[model samples]
Target: MEANELLRKVRKIDIKTRGLSQNIFAGEYHTAFKGRGMTFSEVREYQYGDDVRDIDWNVTARHNHPYVKVYEEERELTVMLLVDVSRSRLFGAVGEEKREMIAEIAATLAYSAITNNDKIGVIFFSDKIEKFIPPKKGKKHILLIIRELLDFTPENQGTDISVALRYFTDALKKRCTTFLISDFIDTHDFTRQLQIACNRHDVIAIQVYDKRDTSLPDVGLMRMTDLETGASRWINTSSKRTRQAYSKWWYERQQSMSDTFSKCRVDHASIATDEDFAHSLMALFKNRGVR
Candidate 1:
């Protein structure tokens, strides 16, 4: 994309995502992800309903009055966005591309993190780590991330989610909330890596897909390309047997992925290219908040 066009696109995404973070996700985001712990703030006069254990006896003795130590939640966290930028993200049939939806979701999450006074970072990965924007605070940092998300391209075309999960687990020693955004179309088994990552840090999966990915339209023979592998083939979409087999394969794949996530104890949500993502996101947040 041209420089001017890229800037306009980034600004457009920023406006929409920022508004969502501020209006819809502010409270739920706060509730879903909590701070590290409470830190001592100051000592104040003891109240009748105050916890007796919190009483500052030393201060009370010195001041000749009852006082209590006050503490506030340490509301500083580092959030990471593990984004998949493989060539497959460019494939979409129902108006919106998976890449576009991924970018928008990432931007929304970044904005939500910043709103909570937290540092936000991103790891863009294809078969390898394409880029890593270190965790930082401020609107400027977020805008820079948005620009990169809009314009950045990957060197590889294949998908290997294990590589990204391994990198994320090794790089960030401190515990953080991570969002793994992808279509979950991997040939490799990432169950072990995902389990390890989730054991160490809080990881949530946001799967973005398209309607065409699950089934084929009954329009006779159609040519299709594997975006990640660059392989091409023609299939008879009008054949009931062919369509049924394809749908069965897709369903089994989804079930297996769901099983992996369940075994890892990870929260996840799936969004389609033509669906309203806001409701799904809100539902995810509400579920987490309740827990």
Candidate 2:
């Protein structure tokens, strides 16, 4: 991508996602992903409903009146975006490519973090860690992330969620909220690693996919290739049995992924490229806030 073109794309994302963060997500995000703990804000005179445990005895004795300690939620947090840059992201099929949707969604979350005064970081991975951006708070840093999301190309073309999670656990010592954004297409079972990571950090999984990933139109014989494995094969799509088999395989895959997520106790949402991702995201955030 050219320098000017990249800037333009970044600007476009900035405009769209910034508005969403400001108008729709900031409060929900803050409520959903809380800070580490509460911090002492100030002391105030005890009210009728004040908790006796929070009463400042020393201050009370000094003033000869009951006073209580007041604390505010710690507002700062470090957020990590665990993004998959595998080759399958290039497929748009019926709508926006998974890669493009990932960029937009990631950018929205980054901006939402900014609104909440949290530091944002990103880890791009395929078969291995492609790049890591340290957590930092600033519009410039966020714009840089958006630029990378829009333009960065990976050296490998595979998916390994476990490898990325392992690397994240070792790299970041503090327990922070991490978003795993991917298609969930890896053949390897990473349930063990996911469980470990979720135990350490607040992990949320967002699965982006294309409609064609689950079903195909009976448009006659067609040839297709696996994006990650580069294996090619011809399929008789016109045959009803072939279509049924493919659909059944897709359903099985979804069920397996759901089971892994359940075992890890991680919150997750799935959205197709053609669907409205904002609604799904907001629903997830609202669910978390209520929890």
- Clash pairs, candidate 1, are none
Off by over 4 Å in 2: none
Candidate 2 local lDDT, 170-228, one digit each (tens): 99989989999999999877888898898899999999999999986899989999999
Model 1 bad stretches (over 4 Å): none
Q: In order, what lDDT does every prediction score?
A: 0.95, 0.93
TM-score of each: 0.98, 0.98
- Residue 133 of model 2 has an lDDT of 98
- After aligning candidate 2 to the native by TM-score, how far in Å is the CA of 238 from where it should be? 0.7
Write down the TM-score for model 2: 0.98
Question: Top model by lDDT, which number?
Answer: 1
Please provide, for model 1 over 44-143, each residue's C-alpha lDDT reduced to its tens digit, 9 standing for 90 to 100. Answer: 9999999999999999999999999999999899999999999999988895999989999999999999999999999999999999999999999999
**Model 1, 43: alpha-carbon shift in Å?**
1.5
lDDT of 2 at 104: 92
